[model samples]
Target: MTSTGAPPDWTTVDIAVPRRSDRLPGISMAGFRQRVPSPVDITMVAHPAVTLLIDLGEGDGIVYDTPGRHERGSVVIGLMPGELRAGGRVGDCLQIRLEPDVAAAALGASPELSGTIASFSDVWGRDAARVEDRLRAAASWDERFTIAADILGRRLDARSPVDPEVAHVWRQTLTSRGRARVDSLAGEVGWSRKRLWSRFGSQLGTSPKRAARLVRFDHAAHLLAAGHAAARVAAESGYVDQSHLHREVKAFTGLTPSAVAVAPWLAIDDIAWPASSPTRNPGTDSPRHRARELGAGGCHERQTAVRDHC
Candidate 1:
């Protein structure tokens, strides 16, 4: 399913999603096409999953920057990549989000890579270019998703997966919206606190506490973007108070709740990532039906569109 354009002023991008059968557990994919050729720049909000941004456009398709670092084209962004921005003339780009456990199995990288960005080539070697070439040659979004899913499935199956116990803990953390306690989780998984902590950190590249905070912050950010009041969001999201929410939001994106509320990045979630809500299951409507309900079947005044460049 896909949505074309929101409010012209809000966004100028078109979004496409895969069929339900194309989705993999703990993985979400979105395709973005820019409607205009003007250069684009966007602040990439931190997300709870490891993200793969595959550039399908020619010539400096996408450029990402963090303090003291710059990378062009396809890149893998880790959880909490502090203060990052993506810019450049993008034509077609595919974004893939992977749960950390799935990422660990697919990427086979160490924990140290989780809080930073890595070039696609650095992770996949020569296969990165080959895969991009195939994706670029595909005729439709569905084809690209199929190829991408096949690749991920192969890699995931080839590797020795993270411990089942660790995977369970991560799922618990997510299902609880980051409210699950580490000690309790460890007990449920039949591991001691220290073992669970060490194993989880080593396998997932983040501690249980940090994962919870990121998951919690992500939920709150979405609520804020969805137009909820900060005070109410703080209360609903399990914060100590409004002040705690402020501090955490600041720590995550270096922005206040108010600023984050209207952020273009978060604004696209309803269309680009409709299945990501922590409190809800994926919608039951057909993709086309859902798109219509979202008023995304066509443009209307004040509607938000994904820009032609991302």
Candidate 2:
């Protein structure tokens, strides 16, 4: 979601992170303190990360939507969701992204929740209220982060992990920005291609080839948001050319390259995540988020990046 010309009642700040220390093998956490009483509607595109948005707001105004489901307050956003719309008077929200491997344990049902969005209450059950209360009572952002980390860590520890080979396949796909070949990954994992594909899909809810393409598209999208020419971004991101890039962008986000170039969510990546975030912007290009059309809705303010593989 994005802000307009008006002075918003709420503003958000990023926690000072020590390098990638906040980066976990199967998970990453970002701290955001948003105090808001806004009326802006946000158009959230599909992100590679399975996101958990913890709303520590004062009221029940924060609304999250996707197809048939419409939830207020806290929600868990599964991977590759269609455009999600969120807006309300949310106060403090903690957004966490987990790799499917670790996510199997952390959120309890993320793997099954793939391609969909659900409220925290739906996924975490009774503990959802208790966790939100704990976060609200936290004294500082650091404390909040610690509490979140502990909660997720405990859950992850409690659940069984995906095979090491499965984890390896995901990591390779992400590190290569989704350009890694599924056949290569299967070979490296020493499993038959069919076996690897079956396991990856069962555990991650996406086929290996689709995951690779999704990550690649995500990389191209960020590059476009950074203001690189579509041609250059396409080439660097391993797309055939600008036309191919266009097709892929539309396939996933349902928006043209120019439209995605100014998405408000991609605009705030540098600010929300600085040192630990991986984006290349040297200030020559700037995203024009004021342009009011992203698929069927508009971006309101901040959104998390999908660096799930990293």
Candidate number with greatest lDDT: 1
Location of the lowest summed lDDT over 10 successive residues in candidate 2? 290-299
Candidate 2 error regions (>4 Å): 1-23, 274-278, 284-310
lDDT of each: 0.77, 0.68
- Tens digits of per-residue lDDT for model 1, 1-310: 1111222233366677777777899888888777666677677767889999999988867888888889999999887788787778878889898999988989887375677888999987779999999999998777888889999998888999999999999999998889888999999989999999999999999999999999998888878766688999999999999999999998887778987765655545666686564332243232211233223322211223443222
lDDT for model 2 comes to 0.68
TM-score of each: 0.88, 0.84
User: What does candidate 2's lDDT look like per residue over 1-310, in tens digits?
Assistant: 2211122322333222212433566666655544334454567776667888888767665787778888898888877777677766656777777777677666667567788888889898888999999988987656776777777767777888888899899999889888888888999989999999898888887788988887787777778767789999999999988999999988777779987776655655545443223466666232232222112112123333221111
Model 1, residue 195: distance off in Å is 0.8
Q: Which stretches of candidate 1 lie over 4 Å from their true place?
A: 1-11, 278-310
